[model samples]
Target chain A: MILKSKVAGKLLRIMLISSIIFAVISLVTTFLFVYNEQLYLKIYKFDQFISVFYMILYYLLIIVYLVWLYKAHKDLVELNTMYPITPKGALARVMIPIYSLWGMWNVYSTMYDHFRPIKSTEKLGSQLKVFIPFYYFLFLITNGLNRVLLKSNTGLYEVSDILYLVSYSLDLILLFVFLKMVNIVMKALDLLMVVKQDIIDDTQDVSGQPKVSS
Target chain B: MNLITKIKEKKEYSLAIILLIIPLIAAVVMMYPKHEEFVATGDITSVEELGVEGSVYFTYVHEGIIENLYEKFSVSLTSRNEIEFSSLDQHQYENYTAYYETSDKYKHNTIVNAVQNAEVKTDSQTIKISEKSQKIMEKSSDYIGDSFGLMIAIGLIEEWNDEDFSQNNQYIISGTGTIEYDGTVGSVGAIRHKLLSAEMNDVDIFFVPKDREYYADKNFSNQVEAKKVVKEEQLTVKVIPVANLDEALEYLRKLP
Candidate 1:
C-alpha cells in the first residue's frame, strides 16, 4: 500500500509494457542466433544489449508486481473491515514456500467473499473463484516440476525443454490475467467504498453514536 | 516552469526526477556501442583435447559489450586487467570469429588429412600414425580454432609412437598452433594468455609455433612471446618451438 492504487496501476502498466517489448526482442534474438549463426554474430552486440535490457525489465516487473500485490491486499482489508490477513502478512505470504498458495487463497477468497454480496462487484467476485486457485496451482506445479527436472541428470533433461515451454506459456497467460486482476481490484475498491458506507449506516440503529466517518 | 519557480514552490520534484532518470540513462549508456574484448580461460587438456584424436575449439565472443549485468558494471575492473581486456574491436571480433569458423571448416579437415598421411620413424621403422578409416577427430565446441591443429596432429602421433611427451613422461602436455596444409605449424594470436592457461592447467610441455616473419610483429613470434612469459614468470613448463608437424613428430619420437 506504499504506492496508492492509481499510481501503482500506472507504474505497473508502464513496467509491464516495457517488459513485454524487451522479452519479445530477446526471444527474437534467440531465434536469430539459433537459425542463422552468421547473422547472429553480425548483430551479436545488439543481442547482448537487448538481453541486459530484458533482465533489468524483468527485475522491475517483479518489484511492480509486489507493489500491486501489497496495494490490492490493503484495498481488500479496507473494504471487508475484517483483518483475515494484514496487508504485510499477505504480502510476505506471497513468497513463503509451502504456504504461498494457501496465503493467496485466504486473501483472494476473502476479497471474493466480500465482493460477492455487493451489487456492483458480484461479477468480478465470480472471476476470483476460478482465478485465485488456478493461478497458484498452475505455477506451483510448473515451477515445482522445473526444480524436479533439474535434479534429474539423465532422461528428464530432455523433457525439461517441454516443461520450460509449458511454464513460460502459463507465464504469458498470467500476464493478461494479472492486468485484469489489477483492474478488477481497482473497480472493487471503488464499488466496495459504497458497501462500507452502507455497513456504517446500518450499524447506527437510527442513532449517530455508532456511525463515525466522512 | 522555471527552476526558480520550483525552488520557491518548495518541492522535491527535482530530486525525484533525478532518481527516476538516472537508471534509465545508465541503461542507455550500457548500450552505448562499446567494443571491449574479454579473455576467459580455455581448456586444452580436459575432454578430448589431447586424446588420440580430439579438438578443443575456441569461442569468439567478439561482441562490443558483455554478457551479464554485473560484468557491465565492472568496466573499470575489466579495463585494468590485461588478460581480461583486449583491443579487439567489432571488426577484429568478426575477423576472429570468422577465423574460428573457417578453421573448423578447413583446418580441422586438413589436420586430419595431414595426420593420417604423416609418417614418423619409431625405434624400428617409419609408419603412418593412424589409418584413414580409424582416425576421426572429435570436435568439442561449436567453433574450432586453428591453434588446435598442431595438437590434433600430435595426439595421433603420440598414440602411434607409444609416446607420452609430458615431462619425464609424468606431467601433462598442451600447446597452441595451427597446422598448415603442408604440415607447417602456423602462429596464433594471444599466445601469452594461452600459455598462462596451459600453465594453470598444469601442462609440462607447451608446443608453440617457431618464429615466422609473416605473422611476427617486430620479430616477436608466438614462440618468443610464449618463452618470454615463461622465463619472466618463472613458469615450470618447458616451451618447445615446432616449425612444422615433422618437427613436432620428431620431438615426440626423440623424447626419452
Candidate 2:
C-alpha cells in the first residue's frame, strides 16, 4: 500500500478548483460580451491579459496532472504491468505530437485494464472506462457543432442559438465530470493509505510484549 | 525517509509547502500579462499587387485577482467547490441587454454596407463574407462594431480595384470609422486604445472620423481624441481625419 503525500491531495484540490474558476471566467466573459457588448469593450478591457492568465493556469494544471499520472503508472510497473509500459513510456505517448490524441486514449484504457482487477479500485476503473469514450465523443461533437454553427452565418439569438447554449452547457457538465473523476481517484488513494497505516498501528499494539510460551 | 526529506519524515509539510508556493507563482505570472494575443499581426494582402489591409481582432476572456485570493481560502473551508458567477461584480450587463439585442440583430447590415460602399459588385449584390469575416460578425469579438467599417471598406475597394489607392505601397496603413449608406464616415467610441495599438504595431497612417459636428464634448470625438493622444504621447503613427470615403481616398491619392 502506498503512503500518500499531503502535497498531492492539496494539489489535486487546487487543480480541481482552478479548472472550475477558469471555466467560470470564460462563461462570465462570454456572457458580458453578448449581454452588453459596448460596456464589455469599454470597461473590462483586460480580455487578453485574462487569456494569458488562463494559459498559465492551464499549463500548471497539466504539469501537476502528468506528474501524478506518472507516479500511478510507476506503481503498476513495479508490480509488472500487464501492458509492458514504463512510466516514462506512458508519458512519451502522451507528450508526443500527432500520436498523443490516440496515445492518451490508449493510456487510459491500459490503466483501466490494470486497475480493474484490484478490489479497492475496481468500481473507479470500470466507471472511468465507460466515461472515457463518452467524453471523447462529446468533445468531438461539441467542437464540430460549434464550427458548423459559426460558419453557417445563420446569425445569433434564434432557434439555432439554443444549440450554442446547449454546447456550452455540455462543456460545463463535462468539465465537472472530469474534475469529479479526479476527485474520486484521489480520495480512494488517500483512503487506501490511511487504512494501511491503521492496520500497521493495530499490529504494533498487539505485538507490544512478547507472548509467553503456552 | 530520504525521498523528499521533510515530506518523507512528516507528510503534512507537503501541504504547507504547496499552500505557500502556489499563490507566489500565480502572483508572478500575473505581473507580465499581455495586451494583445493576435490572430494576425501587420499582414497586408496583395490582390494582383494592390495592398489591402484589415484591423486585427482577438476573442475575449476574463480574470481577477480577487478570485485567486478567494480560492486560497476556499480549499481550506469547504469540500464542495461551488461555481460562483456573483464573484464578478455587477457590470454593464444589467442595463445594456436591450442595446446588445438590437445591435446584434442589425450587426450584419454594418458589415454588408461596408462591402457595398467599396462598390465591389458581389453575386447579385449579396455580400458573401469570408469565413474569417463571418466569425467576427457575431458578438464573438470586440471587433463587432462600426469603427472597423472604414478600414474594411478601404480594404475591399483596394481588393475590388486590384490596386492600392495611395499607389505608394510603401507604408502599412489601418484605421476606424462608421460607413454610412452614402459613403459617409461616422464617429465611434474608444479610439485611444486603437491608436495606441496602431503606434505599437508601427502602422504608418490611420484614418479616424472627423469631428465636423460641434458638440459640448466634441473633444471626446474619435478624431480629436486620437490627435490629442498622438500629440501627448508623441506616437509615431500619423492620425488622419476624414469626413467620408471620398475624403480618405483624396488624401491617399495625394500621398507622395
| Winner by TM-score | 1
Off by over 4 Å in 1: A1-3, A17-50, A95-126, A137-168, A201-214, B1-27, B45-83, B89-113, B116-141, B158-171, B212-220, B228-237, B254-256
The sequence of per-residue lDDT tens digits that candidate 1 reaches over residues A1-214 is 1224555665676666556565566656666665677988898767766655665666667776787778766766666557577778877777787777677567678778878887889998988776876766766775676466454422223453444445445555556566666677677777777677777778785765685567
Question: Per-residue CA lDDT of candidate 2, range A161-193, in tens?
Answer: 446556566656666766766665565455445
- TM-scores of the candidates in the order shown: 0.68, 0.44
Of candidate 2 chain B, the 10-residue stretch with the lowest lDDT total is B56-65
Q: What is chain B's TM-score across the candidates, in the order shown?
A: 0.68, 0.58
In candidate 2, what are the lDDT values of residues B1-256, reduced to their tens digit? 4768857565445653564356446645554422221111122222212223422221111211222332323222222212223232234433234444565544555556666677643233444555424543642343333556666677666655554754554776777777787888888655665666576666788788887574568787777798788999899987889988888877876878
Deviation (Å) of A213 in candidate 2:
21
- Measured by lDDT, the strongest candidate is 1
